[model samples]
Target chain A: MDMRAAVFRGPGEIAIEDVPKPALDAPTDAVVRVTHTAICGSDLWPYRGQEDRDVPSRIGHEPMGIVEEVGEEVRSVAPGDRVFAPFVTSCGECEFCRKGLHTSCVNGGFWGGEDGGAQGEYVRARHADGTLVRVPDRHADDEETLQAILPLTDVMGTGHHAAVSAGVDAGSTCIVVGDGAVGLCGVLAARRLGAERIIAMGHHEDRLALAESFGATDTIAARGEEAVERAQELTYGGANHVMECVGSTGAMNTAIEVCRPGGTVGYVGVPHGIEDDGLDIFGLFMDNISLNGGIAPVRAYADELLADVLGGTLDPSPIFTKTVDLDGVPEGYRAMDEREAIKVLVKP
Target chain B: MDMRAAVFRGPGEIAIEDVPKPALDAPTDAVVRVTHTAICGSDLWPYRGQEDRDVPSRIGHEPMGIVEEVGEEVRSVAPGDRVFAPFVTSCGECEFCRKGLHTSCVNGGFWGGEDGGAQGEYVRARHADGTLVRVPDRHADDEETLQAILPLTDVMGTGHHAAVSAGVDAGSTCIVVGDGAVGLCGVLAARRLGAERIIAMGHHEDRLALAESFGATDTIAARGEEAVERAQELTYGGANHVMECVGSTGAMNTAIEVCRPGGTVGYVGVPHGIEDDGLDIFGLFMDNISLNGGIAPVRAYADELLADVLGGTLDPSPIFTKTVDLDGVPEGYRAMDEREAIKVLVKP
Candidate 1:
């Protein structure tokens, strides 16, 4: 069988191509019909030529869909079950997976590697039992509910991981660095974790407003030293918890600078220019600022975040400001990269 | 009156010179006649010409002494009280201090600046009530008790900070890097915190032996790649809690390399060549390793560690392998620089 999938040709180029449709290649694998997918800020890295990638690579990772077929070993989801997989697939019982570090699972892999691209009609999930999350059948046809929980496959769980790493607790103050979907999700996650003061730093006025609605007590559209000063002034020195959603060296430094002594900076930002510039580690060591977080173990947090979404208490759907079909994925990438869209959702 | 104090003549030189005796300089000041002091690994930076400093400057910060005089506002101790001061003098009531970040206290200053050098017979204490911790009158004149508590002024407290920063918990495993007095004390601290397994890494055989007595379950004196391999082999990948007590760039890298995913590296090492070599922050991010710790908040941990010391469960005094009188201050520097002594104890 053949299916339409988004393929990355090179920088600034994504194309729709007919690729082999995902099938249950292993007993632990399940084939999914992707009803929804998303264009992430991370995707823009390759599109903008900031990160290197092999040409003709399968594109996209976040996927929400129906299980088209499941292998004999896939027990959790049956055909026609509405399911979503995390950014990475992993064997449920690996030492790391058992310890909630699924990102480091011994048998884990990304969606666009051996599996079909997420922005496709069909995708394959390896280690299906450990990777797939089933939504209640009652919400199978609910478009509103599906839209609300789509970000949970990546950004929401990632934001929650940032909050957890930063030690955001009841009555704690926090500063979220970035204006992207993940950063907005961080504000929501901080709120969910009972943070009393969520100060958001971003450059977009519209996004800053969105952050406030997402439960940020304050928002500042500043960069560099000014951003640090404003955040510190608001927190009466610096916030104890900071989230770095942007991977730039400047964002990392701001996250650290706005973190108070004995505080923590939870950074889920994938390093961009860090290899070239390095981090101000001596500064981090001197100030007692704990730098925590890396690639979020998004799978480990799925159940809890899904529960919140199902309960109708969490809504991250507003981040999907643009919608597209499989053919629109190239445009989706362009929209996100040009800041014309906060995040683009694809209905395949 | 004049007091003999150790002064930094430059790299590879320490000279004892008579300086005017310290007196109460502020309303909160206390003048202490030094009874005991010790050389810190940090002090060697200037002695080895690794760190820049003004020549002929006063040296030494850790001091245990008898309070000879007190200004009117000093409420914690009166004349004739036996006390010890942390490396940095902080006004305990400051925002950072009240939260147990005394090292970042707004009114904090180092002992050898403005105040008198701790290596001198007399040193003036600023923010006396907040900076000085008094020993019980019963144990005041006991030589054994005095020696047992002297390291609390610096190394012991420092090691304790590392354990706390590393989040050492009951039934956890830990790896302490370095064989200095602080590293030995870190082994003790981890044991005190109920870590089930403690691995000590260093280059010295005698110090590793000391670490064993201090509760290290394993000791590996390897460096670089071999060090990482041996530690990983012993720890089943890597321990979740690693304490970097050695300030060298190589030690920091080893600490990071040996920390497991979702683990933390509690670094108390005053970074030596990090500015030049830089840290592999991207690697840390990729591994999900958290970097926690800075200059230890020694004063913040004094009370709890002191109680443990007085309870006969902890004995870190063994780290002081050699003791010298006031005139042996120059030799004390040489012995530590040459690693002839784990730490040098000075009595004036």
Candidate 2:
């Protein structure tokens, strides 16, 4: 079978090509027919060559699909099941999975790192029972809403992990140090977790407004510790929880600074390692704050978030401001890279 | 009232002379008649003039005394009460005291730093209700037991804070990366917190034995990551909690290496700053581990520990390997500085 797929040929250039369709290989694997996919900031990372893509590779990590075929070992679902796959693939029975730490499973590989791509009409997914979350087919009419739900595969789940890892509790005051989709999703997670106050920091008016819509009680229009100072002033003394989403030393510092003594700072940012000021052990100790947070175990949250979306408890659709066909996915990356769009949804 | 006390006239020498007795001050303060005191490694830092210290300073930070006089507002205890004062003085009215974070209070001051000494008889204590814990009068008969309890004022509390900050839980493996008094105290704290297996590292056999007595189930004779590797071997993979009590860059690195993926580390050692290696952030994010711990809020835990001692639940007396009179306090510092003694308890 011939399938349309978005292939990243070079920097700022992606092309829709007719690729061979996927087949179920592993007994626990499934071949999904892609219906909705979204462009993440992480996808833009390779598109701008910030993460350096040398060879031609498929682009999307956030995608929801219909399981057209499943291997004999797949007991949870059959043909025609709608599901969202985790950004990382994992074996169901590893030591990590037993502890519900699926993201760092020893047997798992990340989508962008290896194996296969999700930005295609048909893609092979291994360990289907563990990696894919089944969604209701009735919601297919609202693909943007479903596409929004797809980010639960990575960003939204990651945001939740940040808040959870930092031990954000009821009535906690939270400071989110970035205005990206992950940070905005952090605002959503903080709100869901019952945080009393959320200070969203970003320079862009659009992103800040999106933060407000997602449950940021206040917006700090500054960056770095200046933003932290604003959050501290608004929070009275300091915030109870701080989520660092931007992978920079500046953002990391602000995350630590905005949190009060005995508070916890959950940092989800992947630092590029320029100014590594995250080495402030002295300050962290003297202030009596706990710092934690890292890669999100998306597989752990997929089923619950899918149920939440279908139940109408959360509508994450507003994050997707633009939509593009498979061929237009290349321009979508450019738009996101240039800050012209918040998020882009890709229909295959 | 004339009292015989040690006066630090200059570096390298202290004179035991008749000094005017300390009297009542603030309504919330108390006058403590010094009975037993200890020479800390930190005290040596000032005594040898290795640390920036004021000459002619009365230099003692660890002491247990009897309440000779209590101000009218002192409601926690009355005159003739046996007590132990924390190294840091804290005002209970501050925002920090409300949250039980007395160490970082605006009105908090360190003993023998900007605030004068506890070396004198009838020492003046500010905010007495918040800064002092009543020692059981029964334990006063056992001078050695009380002497061993002296380190609990600062070192023990600091170590406890390290483990507590890292969130040490039951049935977990922990690694203590220093064999100093605080590190040995960490062994006790980790044991009290229900750590199933504790691995302690140091160069001395006597200190190692002390660690074993204090509840370190295993001992590693090496330093740095080699010690960490051995701890990992003993614990199967890595420790769930790691305590860094040695104030050096090498010890910090050891603490980082001994922790498991998604584990927590508590560092109480004052860091000397070595920032070239990006290992800290890398271990934190890539492994999803967290690092916490700092200066111990001694005032917060003194009462509970005093209760523990009084209730016969804990015996911390084995830590005091040497005891000397007030005149021998300076010699005690020299002994600890020269590594001839594990800890020295001074009786005034």
Candidate 3:
């Protein structure tokens, strides 16, 4: 079957092409007919070849789709099921999966491309039974509104995980470093978790505005040391929870600087190695601050977050400030990479 | 009342001087007749005048004594009660107390020296109800055997808290950095917590051997990166939990470095103004290793550890390698600071 697909020919290049549809490869596998896919800031990483794009591989990991085909082993879902796929596909049985740490599952890999990314029309999801969460049928017809749920597949879940890992709780002050979609989502997660104060650090006013909408009680546009001091001022010394969403040396430094003594810094940002100054370890050790966060266990929070979306208790859509057709996927990547949008929704 | 006390009349000069007996000041305070006190590694920090010693305060914080007098407000312990005093005196009603973080309680303060150190015949212990844990009456007669328990007042409790804070549990592997008494105690604590594997890292053969006796399954006599690599090799990559008990920047770094992805480094080491490399925020972000620990909530773990000592479930006494009369207290400090003794017990 010929399916319209967004093909990444190379870095900074994308073209609409007719690609062969995905099929059931294993008894636990399922083929999701793409209904909604979202452009993630992470997507920009590979799109710009900054993440060492495995050439010719489809590149997207946030999508909601209809279960057009279900393997025989699948029991939780069936054909015609509306579902949201977790970014990383995991086998139901594994040490990591047993502990609900799906991202680190030995037998599980991500979805979406040939390497299991989600940029194409038809995407194969391995370990379909444990990795896919059924979406409500009501939101199926409103793909635009429901499209926002796609980011929850990775970004929203990631942000929530950051807050949870950092031990953000009621009465705690939280600080989210970076103004990207994940950072904004972190602010939302902090608010939902009942953080008394949420400080969103960003250099962009527009992004800061979006962060405010996502429940950031305060925003600091400063970078580096100044940014940390501003967060400290807002939180009456330093934040109890610091979420590092931007994967950079500076953002990492900001997290440590802004977290209070006896607080925790949950970092989900993938770091590019930087030299050790010996100060971070000293602060972490002396202050009793817990630093914890990594790959998001998307499946862990999928059901709860999806229920929130269906009931309208939470709106993650504000992060989607731009949208583009599958054919214009390259431009969407450019917009996100250039900071033109917090997140861009892609229509398949 | 005249009492024989180890007095630091001046730097490099300490003599067993006859001093006035201690008195109870607050209603919740108690005056303990010190049966045994410990010369802690920290005690030397001031004894050598490396720390402020101008006030000529008492020089010991680790001690086991009999409650000679109890103020009117004292409820938990009365006169004649045999007790172990936690180094940090806490008011059980404070916010930190409610959360079982007694070491950092709002009204919590260190014992010994300026206020009331245990290096004397009689010592005043403030917040008696919160700061003192009455030992089982059975062990009250065995002062020598229980002298080992003296270190539990500070070092042992601190190590145990380090393990607990890092979330060490059954089937987990842990690395203990530093071979001091506290680090060895941490090894014992990790073992009691059901950790399957414990790696003790130190440079001295004697200390490493002591660590093994304390329940360290393996020993790595290396420092810095080599130490970390040795621990990782012993643990088959890395440990699930790392306890940093040395209270140095180097130990903290080693603990963080040896922890596995998704592991946690519980650091009880009192850091000097030295900065960490921010490994907790940046380097460990992708590894998902959390850095957690600070001043251990010694009050929280004292009862159980004390029980372990009484029940023969744990023998923490080997750490008390030497015992001296009040007159030899200065030599005890020298032994510990010079890395000659694991822990020195001082009897007044």
Candidate 4:
């Protein structure tokens, strides 16, 4: 049986192609029929040729779906259940996983390549018992609730990671870098974590408005040094917690500069220019600033964030400015790459 | 009318010059008679011309002495009392100082240049009440007690900073990178913090033994990759806590590679090669490794460490492998630079 999936044909090209549907390849695996997926900011990396992607390669990692079949060893998730998984799949039993570092789980792997891409109709989840999170049975059919929770599969959890890693807490001040989907969610995460002041730094007006709605107390439509200087002035010589969600050298530098003495810069953006520009270690050292976070272990944060989503206290659906079907997957990529869409939500 | 102080005449040259004695320059200043001070590894930076310094400038920072005079505002110490100050001076009442980040204190400054070098017969202490820690009156004249507590002015407290920054705790495994005085003290600090296993890495045989005496459970004499591999093997994969006591880029890389995912590398070595080599941020990001700490904020950690020193549970006097009087200061610098002595104690 064949299923349609998004494939990278070449730079500036995404194609909807037919591929063999995934099946239970291991005792701990489960085949999930994807009901929801999305084109992430990172997805644009390969789509724009900023990063290399093999021709005809499966793409996408975010997935929220229904379990189609479960192998004998799959216990926590069964067929017919509505579930979601983080960008990275983990056995959830490794030492690192036990400590909430699922990104470093010894037995975890990413979706795509030999495995079915999450942007496909069906994908096999490795370590099903430890990977899939069920949405309780009642809320499974609620479209509004589902949209609110779907982002928890990636961006929302990741944003929470940035905030948590940066030490955002009640009554504290937090400045989030980037205006991307992840950064928008970070503003919400800071608010959720009770940060009294949330400063969002980015140059987009529409996105900045969305950020304010998501509880950002202030916004800086500036770039580079000016953005950093503005953040410092707003927070009175930098804040104790600064979240770097853009992963570029400039963003990292801004985060470091906007961090007060003894403060922390929690960065989750996939580093882009570090190989050439390098991080400012001396500047960080002299100020006694700390560098924390990496590829956030999103699965570790799924539970708390999902609870908030289900409780109606948190919603990040506003980040999805465009929607598409399987046939529009190619356009989805184009819209996001062109900045015509904040994030593209897919339903197949 | 004049007091002799160590002056850096040029790279690789030290001069004992008769400089004018310091007096109370501010209401918060105190003049101290240097009874004991030590040559620090960082002192060699300017001496070797690795870092530029003013020619013929008064040098040295580590100081433990008797308070000879106090400004009207000096409340923490008085005339005839013995006191030790950290390399950096801080007003204890500042927000950073109150939070134990005295190095970043808004009202703090380093201990050289116009302030009068610590390696002098009489020098002034700025913010005396905040910068000076007074030794109990009964133990002031006791040579053995004084020697043990003297290191708290610098190395011992710095080592404690490394350990504390690295999150060393009871039953944890810690790796101390370097075998310098600070590194040896780091081993003691790890033991003090209750680390079950302490690995000291360096190529020096004698220093390794000293580290062992200070509570290193194992030692690796290999350099670079081999050392990282050995540390990994010892910790099964990599340790959760690694103290980087060497400021070289090579040492920083080793610390990163030897840290487990979700672990932190607490670094206190003055960052030396970062400008050219830069830090491995991508490597650090890949493992979720956190880089914590910078220049040791010894003042922040002084009281607790001093309590242990005075209590006799901790004695770092052994780090001072050789002792010299006022006239032997130049030779003291040469001995340390040539590795003939681990650290040189000076009685000015």
Question: Considering DockQ, which of the candidate structures 1 and 3 is the better prediction for this target?
Answer: 1
Please write out the lDDT profile of model 4 over residues A3-36, one tens digit for every residue. Answer: 9998888889888899888888899999999999
User: Higher lDDT: candidate 1 or 3?
Assistant: 1
Candidate 1's residue-wise lDDT over B14-100, tens digit each?
888988787777899999999999988999998999999888788899999999999999999999999999999999998889999
Residue-level lDDT tens digits of model 2 in B1-348:
677677777667777777767677678878887787776766765566655666666778776888878889988878888788888888877888777788877777777522346665557787888777776667766765676568778888888887886677787678888899888988888888899988898888889998998899889998566766788898777777888887666777677777777778887776544344443676667677787866778888877777776666666666677888877876777788888887787777
- TM-score of candidate 3 restricted to chain B? 0.92
At residue A181, candidate 2 shows an lDDT of: 79
- Highest DockQ against the true fold, candidate: 4
Candidate 1 per-residue lDDT over residues A270-336, each given as its tens digit: 8898756767776787788999999999999999999999998899999999999988888888888
The residue-by-residue lDDT of candidate 4 on B39-142, one tens digit each, is: 99999998888888889788888888989989998887889998999999999998899988888889889887767898888778899999999998988999
User: What is the alpha-carbon interface RMSD for each candidate?
Assistant: 1.5, 2.4, 3.5, 1.3
Candidate 4: lDDT of A279? Answer: 78
The true-versus-predicted C-alpha distance at residue A113 of model 4, in Å, is 1.3
The candidate with the higher lDDT, 2 or 4, is 4
Order the candidates by DockQ, highest first — what do you get? 4, 1, 2, 3
Clashing pairs for model 4 are none
lDDT of 2 at B16: 76
- Docking outcome class, model 3: acceptable
Q: Name every residue pair that clashes in candidate 2.
A: none
Q: How well does candidate 2 score on lDDT at residue A218?
A: 91
